[model samples]
Target: MSPELNAPGISEEDKARLTQSGIELSMQNRCGSYLQMNQDVLHAECQEEGIEVLSYRKAMEKYDWLKEYEWKAVPKDKDEITQYVASQTDPKGYVIIAHKGTKNILPIQACLYLGRETIQHVHNIIIAEEGAELHIISGCTSGGHVGQGAAHYGVSEFYIKKNAKISFTMIHTWTENIEVFPRSASIVEENGVFLSNYVCMQPVKKIQMYPTATLKGENSVARFSSIIIASPSSYLDIGSRAILEGKGASAELVTRAITKGGTIISRGQIIGKTAGTKGHLECKGLILKDGTIYAIPEIDGRVVGTELSHEAAVGKLAQEEIEYLMSRGLSEDEATATIIRGFLDVKIAGLPEALQKQIDATIDVAEKAGF
Candidate 1:
């Protein structure tokens, strides 16, 4: 376990930094030098837990993390972005799954590092064998605050085999000026389950992204969840997609948008392409001050043998509900906070225990400020 793992209230990002520092300390004390990128390096520390570490330069070759892979894949190399992407073509972020001859019960962990303030673009490819289970956590943040135009684009793709289980959690809270485009996808096989959670707590100016997970196997399942808070002058366009292509496949999405003087565009979709698939999309928005909040939700089914459901709701705090709370002698802010908490209680309940508590605290703060 990394040092930050034991620290209370520390974020997934801080834990990643500690893990990176620990790896460096181990290499220097045991191997005599810090690990460097762009060099083809592989290690077999343990057969049960296969581990690999690829430097930022090595992860950019196949996966362009600095720019939107499918959304904005053309080219924008003004600030050494192109050079950084070129460096990682040799060996993308290291890969370690079970050997063909052996099967393991432990999930492999990958620790990615951003040792500089320059814009980083990283691409990663992970494959889990039949019946394998892996929990991969990717962390992105700058080592220090540099000048403007310092950004990072991270794109990853995963392939989970039949009966495999994979849980990927990406937490981002970088400098206020940095821009990030994080794109990811997973293809699941029969009886496989994939869970993806995208949590944004930072206040950024401009962001555009919509990560997706497609369930293409029978009895496969996928869940897409997000938590977003928009402040004054900030703009964010974020959403998720779940597509079911086989019988007995299922998908569900839930999103929450909190806006105040800023604009947020949320688009969620559930598409069923074949018979016997089940899918649903739910979008709920909270307009604190009503700068501008647009909620566009779509559910499309091309086959008649499937069940697809979708819902879009936009509104302010309920007047009657607020009045009822205020009648108990609480102030207006307190009443608004009470209603907002009740609105988001169920959503927070489903989050990971650690993250749920953090979100609850944030909601408490938001309520005090008339959120």
Candidate 2:
């Protein structure tokens, strides 16, 4: 086994205990092995015919100390893998760091399984060493679990080193009576780049979030892209931000939101500092029904030599495009679905092969429910 597999944190006994207990869902470490994720144990049974036990905590401890990090999926049970790193944290909870390696290879993925009557707080941290590259994928769904009292609070923090690159892709969905609070932020160093892709599927409750990235180094860059859909009683207050400093730094913010059954508010900002810096913010929203969607894209330039720009558009799906698709053998709903799928494809297409297929299947499931 690789040294990364023997690190310490979760125990082997716990892994075995959780394996024989509950519905064994899919949980994979950087080693790419599936295991059960019960709250009672920190590790899980290996899927390769019991070849090895998967330890969540120990998996996280495998990476370099300079790259300390954490990861956790929502609807976390008591035996979930989380650590109490701080005391004054709001929405008191634990954080699970899946990997913090000096070299970023495979993308990290987390799937949140929620049912009726579930409430949870999940926090994650990602650290990319100088010149490292990393990609993180997250999917939130409530497919098999259902009842009531289902709520979740998710928080994420990331730190990128000089010349590093990090990308985050998040997909959110929930049934009726579900509420979510997702808070995230990242810090970028000189010559580093941070890119975020936010995809929101059918959500019936309220989801308020703002994923921000701060460019504190010279020539650092940030980009934010979003695809949001809100239906009956759904609310989304989400956006992105970037702050640039030093010479030749830059930032870009872009988003696409659609409201049908309820309301959505998008707020985005990009700020520039000192000479040789630039910033841009863009937002576009599509309203499919009588619901409302407010757009706010702000750009601030603090230096005389810096450039700042922003653009926003809010409207329904273009009738011409819809009609054109309908004329091409697609029904009204199909036409709308096609467009929505295309909007999301640009982002999901860049994910890892395994993850890309999963995201595509997720969209297919959502479209079958009328999106």
The residue-by-residue lDDT of candidate 2 on 1-371, one tens digit each, is 12122212324543222222211223433323222121222233222221222333444445455233433211233222223322214423222232233433445544444444656555555556677666555656553345457776666677777887777667666665777777677888888877787777675588877777878888887877777788877887888878777578887777777787688899998877778888888787777788888998888877689899888888767889999999999998889889876765645323455445545665676677776
Q: Residues 15-93, candidate 1: write the lDDT tens digits.
A: 4443422222232222111122212223212324333333434434434642333223222242343345545544344
What is the alpha-carbon lDDT for the whole of candidate 1?
Answer: 0.59
- What is every candidate's alpha-carbon RMSD to the true fold? 7.4, 8.0
Top model by TM-score, which number?
Answer: 2
Worst 10 residues of 1 by lDDT: 29-38
TM-score of 2: 0.73
What local lDDT score does residue 82 receive in model 1, on the 0 to 100 scale? 36
How well does each candidate superpose onto the true structure, as a TM-score? 0.71, 0.73
TM-score quality measure for candidate 1: 0.71
